[model samples]
Target: MSSVSTRASFTAPALALVINAFVWGTSWWPFRQLEARGLHPLWATVLIYAVAVLVILALRPRALGQLLRTPVLWILVLASGTTNAAFNWAVTLGDVVRVVLLFYLMPLWAVLLARLVLREPLTHHAAARVLLALAGAAVVLWPAGRSGWEALPLPRTLPDWLGVLGGFCFALNNVMLRREAHRPEEARALAMFVGGMAVAGTLALVLVGNGMASPPPAPAPGWVAGVAAMALLFLAGNLALQYGAARLPANVTSVVMLTEILFASISALALGGGHLDGQLLGGGALILAAALLSTLSGADAH
Candidate 1:
């Protein structure tokens, strides 16, 4: 018989990462939907991850102890929480395509973070992979000719900058996960869940104080129900991410996870009536091709 089952050990985590991608890809809609009902994205994140924190603590009451012993997990809490806060706010306030294009720049961040944190050597294959990923991002993010080629490739608006910030935080979060893979998974999960609550909750308080963002409105039954549903989805996605990311090399997980862009693109097109013009189609193919090459090369440095 073939060793097909043996091969599955690696392949399965790749598939799990894809599942995580789908959850995140379409996640913006629920945030925006909840926002429409007077729940700000920060508040929505607070509610969703708050539920996640409670659930995790209930299951593993001692999980917090491990995080206390490992100070690095606190960095994870900051990274993961800031990531959600940035992306959720950016997407709700800006064009989905633009925000996603900037956010998916995680591969660029990943290359450097992996080398720095995991001490993974940047092989020639990985160098080439990062270059290709950047090229694809250029294709997708290049400003229209309306700007007459003088436009900087940098993010201009507040939301665009938030997307970039979110990508950096995401890269750090993933790197931390790889570094802490030896620790109890429950501690890692608990740290991330609590980070969401702490970061978003703190920011929400600032905005409310400054009169920029509102408090969690009087909870209408409909919105409360929606928050509960989104929380459950977030919890599931978190578990899937832990399963895949903890098993795979950090860089490989980052590369495979770019499929989230594809998921986001399709969902945006369908829900927002976005037109799939030629440039978008071509750019997406380039991005996907780069990810495929990374998988085949398997330039996964530990």
Candidate 2:
């Protein structure tokens, strides 16, 4: 590529990454709206991701061939799928601020998963990053007025647990991306979108079968339109992620993705959908600081 072309490729991918973060940051609102229309978040997730998957397969039939030839892509499917299912469900059940902060703990998980899966050495910086994240999580999860190491802090609600678990899956998803970096881009994108459908659809079926969630009602034109729009946005964001992750360093992508926390926090608070008290602020700072650490070296190798 020419010098100007090279620069555009780099900058454009980074911008696309930021766009992905922004879309995810603001996505909770639509999930909540769909829930109000009797479409449980899980069901909505299934529908939205199903649509995205159909669109992808229709446009890139060759991507399916790429995926079937790549076994690792199946794991990618599971990781990315569970990440979406857990996060979408958790956001509907928990405060958006709390859920988002928990989810952004991805840096902590990324570092550890990298060390394990990629055999990256644990440096002092990475160790400190882990400690800071742990302390921050403790501070955030510790209930108000309950202080002084009274007990090991634990996630208190369904959303809280789901958020943390989803963060772990997200970290795994990213690690797999790095692991499979040499794969066809269409294949990688196909894995995530298809995973979104398979995982969420399976979970939705189980929940509805057990009466824990209602079967999706006849589509209200209003919510169906909203679901269609959000599905398109998610499809775009996934494409952006593939573009950005391919062009940028993995660590840089992780750090830029942290902007989702800021976007979610501000939007949730402004909309009266979430609270922002002292502990959350302090804890979120520490967690984000750990993520920021990775960007300093501009490398969190897979």
Maximum-lDDT candidate: 2
Off by over 4 Å in 1: 1-19, 145-150, 242-258, 273-275, 297-302
Question: For residues 1-302, what per-residue lDDT tens digits would candidate 1 score against the true structure?
Answer: 35887679778888888988888888888888899999999999999998998898899989978888888899999999999999988888877766777676665677788888888898786687677767766666667764655554555688879888997898788778778878898998898888888899999999999999989989798889999998888777767877887788766886777788878878988899234667656655665565556556654322
TM-score of each candidate? 0.84, 0.91
What local lDDT score does residue 166 receive in model 2, on the 0 to 100 scale? 95
lDDT of 1: 0.80
Q: Find the candidate with the highest TM-score and give its number.
A: 2
Error of 2 at 57 (Å): 1.2
- Each candidate structure's count of clashing pairs: 0, 0
Error of 2 at 163 (Å): 0.4
lDDT of each: 0.80, 0.86
